[model samples]
Target: MKTVICLVHGAGHQPLHYKYLIDALRRHGLTVAAPPLPTSGYDDASATKTHLEDVARVREYLVPFLEQGYEAILVGHSYGGRIITQAAAGLTGEERAAAGQDGGVVALVYIAAFTEKEQPLTPEILGVPPEDVNPATKLLWPEAAIRAMYHDIEPGRANEAVALLQRQSPRDLDGAAVCKSSDVPVPKRYVACRQDRVISFGTQLQFAEAAVAKVVAELESGHSPWLRDDGIRAIVDCVLEFSRRRQDDV
Candidate 1:
């Protein structure tokens, strides 16, 4: 079966923000899906959406591909990590086969995302104050946002990426991980951004260890590593290597 890589974005972000990384993945002859979450967008709709809606949106988008026998590899970023974990429940390849489906999720890859290893996102965890949220849009890290999410990115490009930021529901930060990370039966890998200010490197390691990620890769970038060429290459290499390892295991 073919593999489909689904890249889930974090709060206040859309697929456009990951254009370089997505394009690179597709260039490798891989089918990639980068869906915008219901909890994020530039409208009032996003303010009302919650974690459950985010998970449902992803699963709903992938259902057609799964039924078509295309095995999926879910890659979550930041808040997306929790969504992937829950969205993958009972959707493993084996589980799908048992249910008479041709394909399903085969693995999980997290990039500076939340997991069962950590508590709900807090101001302290983000290295920001509670007041950092935008009053009008409810977006996180509104002030000095570049420092927290794109410090390692080049100035010109980082500004372009930040211009696409949208509103993120505050409810997501308080939502609990309904499913245990260990309970998700699949090959797991974690990509930790070494210079990430939004999610610190030390905290990323803790999440990876807690989830018992079989593989851990490091990139010399901040939270939004996909914004640059070298960072995108590093992430692409990590994912491709992990996919190969997964195939070998099977």
Candidate 2:
């Protein structure tokens, strides 16, 4: 059975934003599952949803694939790290095998995402005042988003990405911190964005350290690393490397 990479988008982002990276992975003969979070919708109910709801949604989406005997690698970006961490619990290959299932989550990949097991992701954690960053009440300001998320991206593409930004739930940000990666029972990898203004390089290191991730990649890019060609290649390389490791183990 082919391994599937379930790519979870960050806060304020939809799966469409990951098209380039997803396409590149597919071109390499890899199966990819990029699902949009419910919190990324523009509806009022979406704005009110929490991170746990997003986790539930992702877990539900993976059921059919798992039932078909396909192993999965949960790949999270930005706030998605929290979602994957929670969703992968009790879904490990070993755990599923014990239950007479042949397929389950085998690994986790975080792309400049939040992984702190203790710190709840709130505006305060993001270093912004609550009044300035209310996702439930307003959408991301395009120019500011470009400056923080796409600084290293080309101007045109950055603008386009900003335009695709959706309203994310503020309540999701207040969701409780996830369990430690050690508790998840799967190998973990983290891709650190050095030039990231939102999630700084130092913070990425801290999160990786806290999670005790087995692999870490340092990239000189902004928050959205996939916006650049080299960044996309690097991510694909990382995913492929993980696949190779899984094969070797098998």
Candidate 3:
């Protein structure tokens, strides 16, 4: 069997956000898993550490699956993207060398995912002033506004989504600083959102370039591409193609 696709969610969001994408991948005969992060009541620093820890936890859960002769493709969105990148970097050189043959992660698909060094999670990356980078600085999202962030979600479902929103820590904002540098040799694909208000299109392009992936697809949706049909199709198609390519290489 091919490796399953591990989906990672962004900060202030949960795995539930990727429901549409997960279902679509499943329909295409792919296994998917999306784990939640530890951002509830965390400060920026603590949240950043927790993000790495979350990556470790996910890797641990995934190891047994890999050991069982299951390969995996990691897919991350926003903060989830950052977590997946760290996880990929954390893999030892020897471990990465054994991928695709037995049970190892074969590729990484970053849906608005973050890249190390090239686009560190600094205040500048977020397009915010140093003084405004504080988590306690009051970044409030009303229930309605939060729903608006997800375009296709119905009002009823949006309310439920808002309930899952957690207060992101400022440390998470600074956490990208401590990421150890590692070359991601696995194949990668970056899905860029053209009208993303949270992370700019330019930043996504820069990240895609840094990832050194062979393909990059742009969606004219907002930050949450999963909320759009065309965006979801783009992601599903990319994963399927990447998986087939990996399988063919084997």
Candidate 4:
């Protein structure tokens, strides 16, 4: 079966945010799927999106490939890690039996992501300021508005990054991870960003400690490495490496 590569971005982001990375992957003759989270397009302040909705959306995209026995490599960044965990669960051995599904996910690559389960998102988990937390779900966190997401980027690009930012409901942001780390039955890899201020190295380490990643790779990049040249290479390299290793295993 041919392998499938899908990219899911973090909160306040759409598939376009991964445009550069996608272009690079395609340049390598790789087919990439960048799914738009339903909760995205925050232009409508009246709507709210949940993590589970994105999970279901991603699962839908992977199901056809899985039913055909195609190996899938899910590359998720930031909040996307939660969706990948839930989306890939159905293709795992246990879920296969329960759902009678034919597809399989070969690997999970988390890029400076958030990997929490069954709890509300918080600054404690994300290593951000506690004041950023909106207890009433009254305010939205604009990821692009913050310089830290792509602090290393060129000046005007920051505004362009903000242009890609989505205003997310606190309800959507607070959605809990549906699947536990133990529920995900596949090789998990973590890409640590040494200079990540959003998800600090210590917090990423805390996530790794709980779930035990099979491989831990590092890059001297900020939260959004896909935005940087080296960061894009690191991400593409990590996923391709994992895919190659999986093929070799077969």
Q: What count of clashes does model 2 give?
A: 0
Query: What is candidate 4's TM-score against the reference?
Result: 0.85
* lDDT for residue 223 in candidate 3, whole number 0-100: 74
In candidate 4, list every pair of residues with a backbone clash: 66-103
Worst 10 residues of 1 by lDDT: 116-125
- Taking every candidate in turn, the Cα RMSD to the unseen true structure, in Å, is 2.1, 2.0, 4.0, 3.2
Model 4, span 121-181: residue lDDT tens: 5666555666654444322244524545777876566567767776554556446567777
Residue 161 of model 4 has an lDDT of 75
Instruction: List the candidate numbers ranked by TM-score, top first.
Output: 2, 1, 4, 3
Provide the lDDT at 73 for model 3. 85
lDDT of each residue in 79-170, candidate 3, tens digit only: 67667777766353237455533576667788876765235555565664455433462233554335335545556655666665666755
Q: What is the lDDT of candidate 1?
A: 0.81
For model 2, the stretches where C-alpha displacement exceeds 4 angstroms are 116-118, 127-139, 173-178
Task: Look at candidate 2 and tell me the lDDT of residue 130.
Answer: 52
Deviation (Å) of 146 in candidate 3: 3.7
Model 1: per-residue Cα lDDT at residue 182? 83
**What is the C-alpha local distance difference test score of candidate 2?**
0.81
- lDDT: worst 10-residue window of model 2: 128-137
lDDT of 2 by residue, 1-250 (tens): 5689999998888898889999999998889888789887766778688877888889888878898988898889988998898888888888899999889998888999876535456556665445555444455466667767887998878888888888877677555744567788888899998888787788888888777775457898889988899889888888888788888877
